[model samples]
Target: MKWKVVVMLGAALTLFGCSKPDAEPTESELSNHQSQQVVIVHGLGRSAWSMQTMSDLISKQGYQVCVVDYPTLRQSIDNTLGESASAISNCLSQFEEADFVHTNQSKTHFVGHSLGGLVIRSYLANHPDFVSSKEMGEVVFLGTPNHGSDVADYFVNNGLLSLLGETATSLTTDPNSFPNSLPQPNYEFGVIAGTQSYPVFSGMFDNSNDGLVSVESTKLEGMKDFVEVDIKHDKLRRDPYVTRLILSFISTGTFDAS
Candidate 1:
């Protein structure tokens, strides 16, 4: 329940930040260097509203930020992927327009949380022409179950994952899933893992989890860098440490181990 509260608070803060007067200008307004846009995607059972904190913080760092939302539990994984791809494509088109109208550049970075991470990776893999590693500056995932989640297994075994349909299986147990489906590790990418465990759902996970995904499972072989922090799943996205790490990676193309 505390995790849910954290998510709600994050949503509220994001809304407040966006609505603030004197909202900062987009990347073009402040930079002569080519503008880099960051597209944020949220997790399952969540909305773009959930990623408000991330969007605000990254935007402050001077990247054009667009937070994407999709119906997580209402669509199949394939359908979700298609929808997510469309959203990303739309964002890219907007970036192209901004380039022609303002910065005159063409590129974007993508960051995703949980299931959103899966969707972004799936899109990049299947549509390499649109979002290749070169065009995609960096890919960052926060607490993604690149290996899959046992909690999802529990839900499916209990017949509770029916509402999620193929999305549940595609995300949870399928070997050909997002991170797994990526062709080659050609993009600059990083992975951040959480170590705090929520007591209410402790029984559902192995040790070293942020209530849902185990820290070890968040590790993927192809990532440029990997980091672990003491934050729960829901709070991890907004945690200053994680946010700072992501910013550092985006700017420097390396994770600050210090």
Candidate 2:
């Protein structure tokens, strides 16, 4: 599939009223002009490069950004969440002023795709003050299974496919399972669900799904905002529309409800 995210350097600036963009920052360029920090985490088995375009576009808004990558297939779900916590603190540590009392400290936002979203949620569960103490900002979940996933069950049921990952069972649809058992975000959060179904496993899900995750499963009890886009699960990181919504929530604490 040919996927292209059409975003310009000045797009974020124009929307945030920061300034005109000189040019697109190279993927390796690090900009720390703004006090706000946005950490981006890729989904299971995905690299930080998958989120590079969205991260670059967000940097145009004048915020420091860190794209996190971890070994999802190799680690247990619990271990991956530990990596998520480590990534968030490590990313925040890069900014000298990212502390609870600092002005910019309150704007530390986390954006994650798929299981990465669950990772953030799990992190917040352990350190619930991520928002209460104002140590962090809102979280944006892209195609996360806040409820749980059936695909995981399918894999766990098939011994042949179980070798794919050690964390698949943690994604079972039972609320008692890891995903649903996670505490809801104590801070402001927005969820974006994909409406397109992955035809292969869509039949397993009783509702509209994005192939791997169902739109219904993407919801939670306390997300501040929710929306659906006609995209796939893995594609959320690269979809221009999805990234724009992420920026909107990051800048304004709410997505375009309309």
User: What is the number of residue pairs that collide in model 2?
Assistant: 1
lDDT tens readout by residue for model 1, 119-230: 7777777776765444567889888877777666665565545654676555554576545665554567899887887665577775688777778777777788888877
Instruction: Report the lDDT of model 2 for residue 80.
Output: 74
What TM-score number comes out for model 2?
0.81
What lDDT tens digits, residue by residue, belong to model 2 across residues 1-258? 111111221221111101223344344332323667788887766778778888877878667788887767656776777777887777867764544234533467889888778877877778755567655777999888777777766655654224435665577787688887877667788999887765555667888887778898888777788988888777777776677788778767777522
TM-score to true structure, per model: 0.80, 0.81
Residue 205, candidate 2: how far off, in angstroms? 1.8
Please report the TM-score between candidate 1 and the true structure.
Answer: 0.80
